[model samples]
Target chain A: MASSISTVPHRAGLGHRLWQSRIDYLFLVPGMVIFGLFILYPLFASQWFSLLNWSGFDANQAFVGFANYAELLQDKYFWDAFARSFIFTLSTVPAQMAVSLVFAIILNNKLLRMSALFRTLIFLPVVTPVAIIGIVMTIMLSPFNGPVNIGLLDAGLINRAIDFLGDPNLVLWTLAGIFVWKWVGVTMVYWLAALQTVPAELYEAAKLDGVKGWQVTFFIVLPMITPFAIVIALISAIGALNVFPLIQSMTQGGPYFASEVMEVYIFRNAFATLNGAVPRLGYASAAGVFFGLAIMVLTILQIFAVRYLRSREKPNGA
Target chain B: MALEAASSAASEYVIRQPLITPRVRRWIVSALLAAVCCIWIYPLVWMVSASFKTNAAIFASEGLIPSQPVFDNYLRAWNEANIGAYFFNTLFVTVGSVLLVTIATAMMGYVLGRRKFLGRGFIFGLLVFTMFVPQGYTIIPVFELLSMLGLGQSLWGVMLATTGGSFVIFVLLFAGYFSQMPDELEEAAKMDGVGFVRTFWYVMLPLSKPIIVTVIVMQTLYAWNDFLLPLVVTLANPAIRTLSVGVYAFKGENFVDWGGMTAASTITIVPVVVLFLFLQRYFIDGLAGAVKG
Candidate 1:
């Protein structure tokens, strides 16, 4: 895409000097200025604030060399949150990706008559407010009066009613389950879109050889959308790492901090960790920088892997 | 002997099986799919049902339809979530941001789509790159930046900050609703010596309805469903709180208002639900374009 765009010839004339168009610059200025002030400057602030010992307040002024990072290294909660975040990324990304891919495959089968309706129904969760989902999941996962427990108990599936949010062992998985439920549809949508771009002729070619449905799906469909599947997986993984608001609304990183993730920890550290949950700017900033770096490294590695595979396949097929 | 000989001769004929038959297997598959659909739709359906349920029914019944449905909870929820104000704030922001971003992106997309330039490669990359960077990665920076601008907790700040969402613009251009124009129309316009602005105004904009509609629906959804930005930046002020934030607030402040809470949630979901059911063809099409682009 980039190479094609780059090869387009540049015409230099009063009529054709596109850059000279005042409207272009005018359109750009508002977006650029806002992004620079809000997004770019704050990105630099992580480095600046990392150097300062000032708590996350504007009025305070103090300079301490590497103390924030040093303190963070010693923080047990930080490590715990990092571990939990990773665990979530591990569990949720693959489950969500696998489930969504399966769903996409099932829906994308030509034999399915109501593909559009199925696609739309699956995607409804993506459109709804995340907060509302958080609320519903909280109520539904509560041990008492929660339908999950009631149904399980009614069917004699469990000897005991499980407190999903209360048990440290279960809380994270519960959260992961909810996350999958919320996100799998979104992944399916991306996969479905990518699936449509696969030519029908590929399937016809494979079918002519007497290949079964699953074989055709695995060999032909999967490889064609490998780049997209990888991209969506990485995005989901990153989202899991940065998850907070749902944690806050549902578990509040609770059941003895069982469900704590990096983003939730960062929020708690900043706005609610100490002193009636007063803001701890310096500490939170330092943590944010730490987690941000960790996430950036993870995301970049995934991107490179995707790109490598994509290009490797490109010589043969897109 | 004759019958036996005929049966032996016809033994080569095999029983053929259809992919799906109107039988027990079909019944099981449909039943299974129906059960799964119910499970999938359960939470959302429960939210709607619970909103109509009385306090006791909400706490007690897990029925598909409320045992005792009533609208009183919804009425109370309107007051309880402070959601009336939230709706106003959210609507204003969603609409206002869509307007600002769409218009700017359209003009930008139009120019970028139509014009050829050096470093256009870089500009398009820069625009597309924003979509990949999760807003959380930049929230702290964005928050601090908003605070510095003295627009902290202000609606306009939220509107402006999200202006970098060039997605709609990017999609519109790449989809090339503009570029797909019959070159003859543009050639004829050029022959008439119409200025570029006049050409875009009279010709391109009129012809760009499919993409423009697509962008409008998509950006509206983005601006509506976005949670974290408001969660982070709008900490101090309550006036600018959107519907999602308001729902979050209700959950936090009032613990036992399950009926009221889901009621408020129902209100939060109403516009999107209606829009989705009614305007879905375009919404799905637009969303497909976003991912597939």
Candidate 2:
């Protein structure tokens, strides 16, 4: 991709400079080729597709510029799915951060024995495939014979079994809860990494000062890690958009499309034949581009946040 | 010395404390952690145990131990459900993609990290910028492009698409690792009349074992667990479905085959679990390094 840029050196012509550095450029070829083919090209292709009215089934495509985006504005389903994506991010990211933060604190405690065992156990779910998690969670939360419901009933928590994934009202929150459980380990790791940044001398000083443990955590530790929490939250929010497999495996954005987020909505329009809906390739691309832009903005903010955090960490800036 | 003195003094005080003494506190923390662990691992434990249970017994009780264990599910999943094929397919795609990524990123990292080159900053900045762009709906174009090249229905297509990302982090990882190498290493190689490629191949690459292992472990987990691209690429060809896509399809077809589903799920998950157990340190540090990088 950068091959187009012709850099003129003070003592050598562009061609001469290129020949001199041919090996370096040769080394970049394989990766750049793959990147251009799979990533860079498709980005532009998706945008171009968003301008056409083409069913994915055929070659007949009518150029309908921005009509899809206009339609997306009035489309209640599109808006609902878009809103749900944000809702999923909002619902899960904080909960994930909070729970993981507490666990990270517990695991970070020096006095805690067998913390590595506990850490490994908590992290076990992070590596499990999301599709498999969806399948297992479906069974475990099955209303009829699921262990979760059975345990609840056995403990007299409720009069009857609740269809966790079947109820449209309850499904999103249920998926959110499972999402947290599956990914909390990752955020916990991030927190642990961040926690490790705090100098041990600070803790020793706090202990020598007779400060209570909880006070030390709330005062010194929390404030010190606040900057890292921002970056962690951003990463988690970006990850929250990647629930396509989980939703696809467990619910397929069903129970009346209640669990449908933007990704699922785009996927359903682009590929799925469910609900007798035709594959609106162009519109799905438009939705994709739109969501992609939103995520890009979040990502940019995160980059800046990280830069700021780094600057703050190293007072003598690089 | 001061640090040790401070910690030892603190421990002495902790041991003398009343009510919630250090020992009692340790037990309380342990109990709490143990409870959480049981909850966390219950589903995985349940799935593994259920694989051995008969279909009737799976629904009869959600017990961790099967009253009547059976090996039929494994045989059926392996023979009937096509998991055995999908496993190999996943292995092939993962290995191929990892090899591609490792080579490409390592080369890129070495060049950009060790040399001053034209467009280096521009190219590096471009890669970083693209990382933030969510790859929404690009799968359609990728699928179409693969088919256009007449490779869409093949596992090779899946491998290409899987590897066809910015991979900015891995590149940065390699770059950062290589950047920290001593200048003398390169000077020594140059003095011996070794050319750039040979020097990298013989000296630089060998020294980057930790980074390479980190990249391989991370990419293996990604390629093994990746679902969406494999689903799209192999949509027209069930014969080439990877483990993740295959497991989902198998579950869809055999909705009530709980025993078979459990067995297939276990087969899909075991390799990853075992890999993580083995390379747990690399996995954790890799994540931290990526974020830090």
Off by over 4 Å in 1: A1-23, A110-113, A205-209, A315-318, B1-30, B110-114, B118-132, B162-192, B199-214
Compare the candidates by DockQ and give the number of the best one: 2
Model 1 docking category: acceptable
> For candidate 1, lDDT tens digit of each residue in B36-79?
76788788988888888877777776576876678887777777
Model 2 Cα lDDT, one tens digit per residue, A215-283 = 777998899888778768877876787888889899989899999998888888888857677788899
Give the poorly placed runs of model 2, Cα more than 4 Å off: A1-12, A275-277, A302-318, B1-19
Per-residue alpha-carbon lDDT of candidate 2 for residues B158-237, written as tens digits (9 for 90 to 100): 99888864366688889988988888888888899999899999999999887888888878877887888898778789
Predicted structure with the largest lDDT when compared to the true one: 2
As a whole number from 0 to 100, the lDDT of residue A30 in candidate 2 is: 92
**TM accuracy, model 1:** 0.85
Pairs of residues at least 3 apart in sequence or in different chains that clash in candidate 2: none
Candidate 2 DockQ vs. native: 0.47
Give the lowest summed-lDDT range of ten residues in model 2 chain A.
A1-10
